[model samples]
Target chain A: MIRVVAGFFIVMVMISAATVYSLKETTQQLKAHKQQLSADILKDRAAIKVLRAEMAYLSQPARLEKLSRRFLALSPARADQMAKSVTSIAGRENFKQVAFPVDEFPLLLPQEKPVFRKKTVIRQPRVRKAGFYDRISLKLEKNE
Target chain B: MRSADLHIEGAKSGALEVARTRLIVPVSLFVFGFSLLLVRLVSIGLFEDISDRVTRRASAKTEIIRERVDILDRNGVVMATNLPAPSLAVRPSLITDPQEVADRIVRLLPDLNRTRVLNKLTSSRHFLYIKRNLTPTQVWKINALGYPGLVLEQAEKRVYPQGRLASHVLGYVDMDNKPQAGVEKFFDDHLSNPERSNDPLYLSIDVRLQYIMREELERAMDKFSARAAAGIIMNVNSGEILAMTSLPDFDGNGAIDPLAPEMKNRNILEPYEMGSGFKTFTVAMALDSGSVKLTDEFDATKPLKVGRRTIHDDHAKKRFLNVPEIYTFSSNIGASLVIRQVGIEVQKDYLERFGLFDKPVIELTGLSRPILPTHWGEIQSMTVSYGHGIAVTPLNMVTAIASVINGGRLIPATLIRKNKGENITSSNDYPQVISPATSRKMRQLMRLAVEKGTGSFARVEGYRVGGKTGTAEKVVNGVYDRTRKITSFVGAFPMDRPQYIVFALFDEPHGTADTFNMATGGWVAAPVVGQVIRRIGPLLGVKPVMDVKTEYQNLILAGNEKK
Candidate 1:
């Protein structure tokens, strides 16, 4: 009976030791996984910072100005090309029609010629020069 | 049989007693230790709390140590940033072959002297830096060498992504992460403190406007072969400096040339006489004090003698001039006469009220004081009226102009970006420098000056540009040098409701064909202001209303003012 009790005690201790070992192993694995995830997040944050800086550098005004000079033949948008409101135009019928910038005083002189497409209106924003003056145009269909 | 059984039982009981004595203490201690171990395991394994605690502690220790806040423009563009740049260092004790390591390092980094690296490798010191600010490519190359001694330790580098665009304003940072000049120096503490460094610092500058103004100044500098140029664009209502630049500026990333002196911002640091630019203040003072009216006339038949120095207009309008004519023609005699009508006491008070006496309080450091006259006499006042005797920085002049044009409230110029929800309107309790009526009149006169007078070149086709031109001969050894002129123009656009102030000045600009051998303010500076207004107007959301003539028909005095 003493021999049997000793055997049972040895088996119970062995089982508990094995459970503890497996538990410790899982904890270590989980710790390692968390560390790796944290490292990835840190790396991603660094990449985002670098990309933001790169975007700003690429969009610098000097570079854009140079590219504009090389590619586009258009000059700086003069004051005459802009109007205070839509009514400043000749008529409602000509609103959708292409508004050509006259050589001088486009607002004062009668429409000499159409310089743009009838489907789109060319308007330069008065604030912030993001500087993509290209063939890309947004199609806006006015509700009748 | 009973006696034999009794003998066995007695033996068994004796044996049991011996066993109990031998094992009881040892078994109890073993059970206690095992129970403690199991409890600890359960706490760690099931709860999983200790790991989180360790992570929080580790992150707190490593990540929250120190960091520098980024500097941004008004539109949230990153102008300056701090990035972790790991640098190569070596443990001399661990280096097996100094010569071999030095040779490889030299091959990878040609700029790093082989001799220096060899010396560092052979030095008695345990650790020494091989190179700083190593690019990722360089780091990769160095790491590939696989020397046990060579290690990369993380360090930070401050970068200005905009390069020379706002070099003077952003200034430069030292290797120690200390800001040496500009906004960096201005808000050093706020940016460097670990507690407050997370939020980015926003400046009032608009990088787009800054680029436009700087380009225009560069063109003027190259075209006229000028020594230097300074320009500024300010929001008249908010006192926000949208753009400011000094020519010969250096890139913030590189070593600044000491000989060039281009890094020195002339706008805020150097004070000039500001010449006829002061005439605007004089005329405005007269109008504000109710000493002069729009129809009031002054005789500008000859140069007025003040003490030994005679104040003369270069292009003298030799006739009786009204208040508008005095400003339009930029008549020094007329300005001096207006000062007399307004009296010297009121002139000093007005100038003092304009914050011309004190140093300009701005975000940037190294601001110079306005050179006030030692003796406030009649001659000083007269010369100061036409902007010669008293000297003030271009920033102060522009700030004062903004106050005059922006509804008569003297708002101190700011470099920090104001939030959208922040109150931008001037306080009712803020002291009124000039009446709203006087402000309107001043705006009209400025427009008329651009229209009919010396500032005609600044007149855009549709935009009603209002401003004054100042051409002051640089003083050489206490005497005015006729050859070298500092010509400047300070103007605001759409004078009916002025929104922005543009000031352009060039130092010692030579005569060009376009300027007709006259390196005057109207010739050089006025055209720069016009170019800037034309290009930047659309970008700033300012719509140029057509019919400038009929709109300001009463204000337009001359026909050539028409575009």
Candidate 2:
């Protein structure tokens, strides 16, 4: 029994020692990972700064204005060209209503349509009211 | 029996001696184990957190490679930022051979002098800097050489990408990472501190509006042959300066001169008489104080004599002009007469209340104070009523005008962008500068001026442009130079409810053939306002109705009844 208790204590010490070693290794790995992520973030931040400066330089209004005039044949919109809404131009009964505003907005919204859904695109010939469909229809009619 | 007892006592003594010897080994072992634990505790106490040590080392490197915050426009356009610029330095003691190292480095960096690099590498000093602000490719080439003595110390360089576009506002920094002027100098504490440098400084300036304003002002200056021109477009209610430009601006990316004409941020720094634009404040103060009524007429038939000087009316009507007529014609005689009835003390008091008597507090450096008269008198009041004898900065004038036309609340002008999802009007801490009724009346009078009076040149189609015109003689050596004029026009659009205010002023503008040899505000400045409003009104999302006349008929009809 004395020898058995001594062996149990020795096993306990070895287990505790292993747990400590594992914990230290995990902490070191975590620390190294955090450092790597931090370094990547710093590098990305520097690259973004350079890119931002480039973007501002490219999108400057003076240059864009010149480019638009040369390439797009667009000019600053006139006040009279603007309206409050689509309904201002036409009534609800008119078929030729103002659908969308025709301005040079770079970002156009997606269309929202409420039309009836077409069930099938494939065209099929009439089945002459025969066979299983004809019998099912007759039974349903009698029941009704 | 005695012999047997002696033998048992001897055995007991021997067993006791054996137990004492065993006790010493266990006690000494415990002491050794505890001592080992104590050393471990001391080492851990010394090291503390490993992350902290790494951070400290990183910071030591970053001190040389400083990180300065970027200044961005409201739309995240980077106006100013830092680029990683590697600077080359050397340890002379570590260099085994100086000449070979210098030759190899000089080959890679042709800009560096071979002699200087050799001398630095061979110097007795432990450390010496060789070259600075190297491109990434040059640094990579030098790194490939694998020289132990030569080290490329990394640092950051501040760069203004917009060049001369927003130079006066962005400011510049020195090689030592010191801020010299503009927003850089003003917000240095926030930039240099490590704990709070992550976020970019967002300004209220919109790049598009700024570009347009600058283009228009430059065009006007070129056309009129003016010495200089300045313009501002501001959101009245929020006190956000959408665009502000001063002509002859310098490139921020180039070499700077603090004393150059291009460096002067005239809108906020310089004070001028502002000519007839001052009349708006006089009329507004009179209406707000209940000293003058909109229907009351002032006899502008003759110049009003005060003490030794006479207040002359530009484009004299020589008739009894109503309040609106005085504003429409920009009558100095009429303005002075109204101030006479309004009293001189009240006029000074009103100007003080409008924040015109002191230096305007804003987020920029070198803001000069307004030039106030040493003594206040009847003549001073009369001249000041017509925009003389008292000089104030254009920014102060715009601030006061914004309050008068923007529901009568005074909000500070700020370059910093307001917080997202935050409403400036929700803050009840702002003081009411004028009554809403007074602001409404001022808007109506300004519209009447633009529609039918001397400001007729300021009419933009499909938008109700309300404004007043001022053409002041440039003061040279404490005397008015008759040949030189500073023509200025201040206007608000959609006068029924004003959203923005535009101010354009040209200094020392010469009369061109197009203007028929007239350098007055009516001829020079009014057309610029009209053109700017017409171009930007639609872009600003202000719907242009064909029936602007009918919609603002109430404001205009009220004035017509008095006429």
Candidate 3:
């Protein structure tokens, strides 16, 4: 009877020790998890700030107006133009090619020409006949 | 011998009874004390656990954690909010080599100065800041360095996605995380807490209308080379501000130097002598007093001299002018003559009733009171009749105009959304300030001004717009400067029922080639109001009326002969 009572008390002590240890481990884990969640919340808040700044920068009126004119082919409404025609053609045409100059012409390079051989032979023969008559007259004059 | 044996046995039994009796009392006392302690422990620890839980929860600071509030447009577009961000910090004492850590950090954060980072890391302080607000990828790269003592602290910052679109209305927060202007400043206390029961402030501002007004006003301001400009669009019935804008405004995240003087909010804070816009009030006072009828005519042929001051009409009638002609031609002489007939006492009462004598009560922080003439003599009343002797903020003028057109209901301007189930029309709360008949007559006179008078530029194609143009010479050192003018225009659209009141003002607008080099309110400010109405009309759910003559035929005809 004495041994049985002693064994029951010892078993109760061991069980109590284990429960306390487990509870302590769980409490530590929970604290760490809470800290991590807090860090994550902070990170998210900072990201929101960055995205807001980027949105503001991109949504600026001057930038949007430029983008609309470039991509959507939008133009300011002219006071004289009728509304129906303006709306129809405003974003339909490709403005890139429309702005190109259509009146410009390409420059041409100069070319060389060939000479005729028949004309050259006739000039040589006439020069030889005139030289012989001139030489004979010059010899008679020198002798005189 | 048998009797002696019996006597000895009895004596032994008696001794045993005595021993048992002594043990009984002490044992019973010990058992009773142990049981009492056990019962007390169980009662305190288990039975009252809920009360203990309540106590612990009350003492905890779990609710104090900073949480961001949502800022939404009238259409529920998210304008401002908070998101998480990782920042780099370090436990300096635990770092093995400060130089190595700094070099690695510089490689990851190229914007960081290597020398400065090294110095911070080498400090003996337990915690040192290496960089702030790092991107996730940058933080990941820094973490991969496997360096000890590195810490990443998390923080929240304000964000404005619409940028400068509504900068003035959605004022920016300072580095200390305090809202500084516009709605942000006006609703800071409610936005800063999560546990508070106050609902989020819902403004009457429509972002789309705001954008349209900003775009059109910017274009006009640029075209006119105006020094500064401000505009407002108010619901004439509810007195809700649909859109309000002032130029030279900074983006929410844009750097604002504290020393710069240009950061002032011109719409609510700046006071100007709002020239001829006051004519509406003066005329209203005269008509309301029964001193002058619509048919009553006054001589406006020449400048009227009162005491030492002379009030001249910009467009001289040089003949008898009736009520419609006084407003249509913007005759200063005629307005003065009408006010003189109304007398000083009546004029003062009307101006005070219009809420012009006090500082405008608005939700925003900055507000300026109108500078009224000190001495209330005939000259002061006459000049004020033409909007020269008094100066008021744009907001004050807009609200007063709204009151006149909304059938005389003086609704206090508010930024917070009205609670449901609350009766909005309870006389105990909101009382009618003006009669519907007076409102209708004022609408007719305003329409006449726009149709044939100085506010011709305010006329929209389909909308029956009515307005008054005011071009007052800015007073410098108590003397009116002829060259510097504060040109302003205030108008209400669909004059038959009068829904929206739009007011635009330009300070010291320089003459532009398109304006025929005229910087007067009729030439510069009226066009802006017209454009604002044209762009914002559809956004505010006000459909354009193609046939204006059919809508307000009776009232238009009653005031038609002068036009």
Candidate 4:
């Protein structure tokens, strides 16, 4: 009975020791991973800071103006480029159309006579039913 | 047979006792050892709190420490930030060959002196810094050299990526991590607070408008060959300074002498006799008092003598001018007469109410107080009417003029971004300077001035810009110097409902060929304000109201045109 009790105590201790050692190993690994993630976050933050500074330096108005002058055909917008409302712009466009009516263009000049030309019509090709041998011959010709 | 049985039983009992004693010894030892182990494990899991300690250490290692918070524009653009800069230091005792190491370092950094570096490396000191704030490439090269004695210390260095853009506003941080000037000096505590260092401080400045105003002012300065120039653009209703610039400004990232003349923020720090820009206030004062009407006439037929001084209009109409004509023609005699009618007490009260009596409230260092005359007498009031005797900073002038045009409310000027709920109508800090009706009339008169008078050069076709021109002889050694003049213009647009106020001043501007050798405010300063409005109007999203009938036009139609 003493031997049996001693054997049970040794088995229990071994199992608990194993569990504690494995738990300790996993905890250490997790701790190391957490540290690595934090370090990565810090590195990323610094990188983002550097990138922001670079972006601000690149997007300065004077530099942008110089770049635009060199490469773009755009100019500062003017008041005339903007309209109060869509209807107002549409009205302006309609007024521009009315300002130069197509019918009035000739009447305003009335100096040149109109030229006349004969009308030409386009012809459509006719379709015809084909035999199986004809279709086979056409396919053979396409293959060739 | 009974005797033999007793003897065997006794022997059996003795063996049993011996076996039991041996088992109890081993069993007690095992129980004591196992209980100790179990107690240790329980204590470690429950009482010791190992995980708590680990998490605390992890958090401490990851916490980022910053030297200072970033400064940003209203649009969230980084105006100033801190960048990681690795510094180089060395232990002299650990170095075997100082000359070779110094030579290699000098080769890597061309700007460093060879002899100085060698001396530092060979010095008796235990440790010394070779350089601070090394570039990334330099750090990489030093790391490649693999010197265990050479250590790279991690540090943060403040950098302004925008360079000279808004330099005066952002100020600079020194190597000692001290806030030197401008917004940096004003909010040093808040910026250095470790708890809030992660958040950035935002100003009311718009970089685009700031750039536009600075570019135009620099161009104007070069064109007119002025000694100095300053410009300001403020939101009229909220009193937010959108852009403020003083020319000959230094780069925020470069070395700066804080005592240099260019370091002065002329917009708020220097006071000048703002000439006829004050006439807007004079006219506003006259109309708001209910003592003088817009149609009331002031005699500008001749020079008016008050005590030993004689006041005359630069552009003399030589006639009895009405209030609109007085403002339109910019007649000094007419403005004096109007102020005289309003009396000195009323004038003083109105000027004080306009905040000209005190320094302007803004987030900047070294704001100047308006220079008032020692004695409040008739002659002083007469000269002050046309902005002669009293000297005020451009910031004060702009704020006061903003009040006049923004429907008679005196909103204090600010550089910080006011919250959405904070505005002129919602805030009780702003005082009513003039009646809304009088404010409207003043707007009409200003419109008339820009439309057909001295401020005609400031007129932008579709924007309806209205303003006043000021040309004052700068005082030299207690005497007015005719050759030295300060010309300025203060205006707002779209005069029907003014939103932004633009002010430009040129100190001692020489006459250009295009200006017909005329260095007056109308020639030099009005066009600057006009050009600024033409450029920044669209950027501010102010829609150009075309063909809108203004009060000035109606007055003109009624045959009440003053000019």
Clashes of each: 7, 0, 15, 0
**Candidate 4 residue lDDT tens string, B1-563:** 65324433565888876776678766886897689789979986786646755664655464566668888887778889888888899998888888899889999988899999988888899889889989999999999988787889878888988888798888777886788888988999888887887788989888888999999899999999998999999999888988999987898777788789889889988899999888899989998887888778777779999888888789887878778778888889989999989999999999999999999889888889999999989999989999999999999999999889888888988888776567547425678898888889888888888888898889886798999999999999999999999999988998988989999999999998899989999999999999999998877767788776556454433434444
Can you tell me which runs of candidate 1 are displaced by over 4 Å?
A1-36, A71-76, A93-144, B1-65, B257-260, B421-423, B548-563
Q: After superposition, how far is residue A13 of candidate 2 from its true place, in Å?
A: 5.0
What TM-score fits each model? 0.80, 0.78, 0.71, 0.82
Q: Which parts of model 4 have CA positions greater than 4 angstroms off? A: A1-21, A91-144, B1-64, B552-563
lDDT of 3 by residue, B1-563 (tens): 65325433565887866666667755885697579679968986775445634544343433344755657665444567655566789998889988888888888888888888988888878897776667779878877998878998766667766767677777778865688777888888788877542244556676667787788778888887777888888876666777888987777765776445546677788888998899898888777778888778788767788888788878875777778778777888988999989999988877788888888767788788889899999888888898987899998899888878877766766554443333234434544555667777889889878887799999887677899999999888978899899999998988888888888999888888877889998899898889887766544545455555432333424544553
lDDT of 1: 0.82
The per-model lDDT (C-alpha) reads 0.82, 0.80, 0.74, 0.84
Candidate 3 local accuracy as lDDT?
Answer: 0.74
lDDT of 2 by residue, B215-295 (tens): 888998999999888888888767888777888898876667778888888888888778998899889988898999877
User: C-alpha displacement of B526 in model 1, angstroms?
Assistant: 0.7
In model 1 chain A, the worst 10-residue window by lDDT is: A132-141
Q: Indicate the residue-level lDDT of B81 in model 1.
A: 86
For candidate 4 chain B, which ten residues in a row score worst on lDDT?
B554-563
- Give the range of the ten consecutive residues with the poorest summed lDDT in model 4 chain A: A101-110
Model 1 chain B weakest 10-residue run by lDDT: B554-563
What are the per-residue Cα lDDT tens digits for candidate 2 across A1-144? 985897688668767876676567566645665666676566666566677677778777788878998899777888777766655655644446646554332422223322466888857865664544345445656999
Q: Say which prediction, candidate 1 or candidate 2, comes out ahead on DockQ.
A: 2
Instruction: For candidate 1, list the clashing residue pairs, or say none.
Output: A126-B538, A126-B539, A126-B540, A126-B541, A127-B539, A127-B540, A127-B541
Q: For model 1, how does the per-residue alpha-carbon lDDT over B403-475 read when each residue is reduced to its tens digit?
A: 8988788887888887655526855735578888888888988887888789999988778889999988898
How many steric overlaps does candidate 4 have? 0
Displacement of the residue B397 alpha carbon in candidate 4, Å: 0.8
In candidate 2, which residue pairs clash? none
TM-score of chain A of 1: 0.41
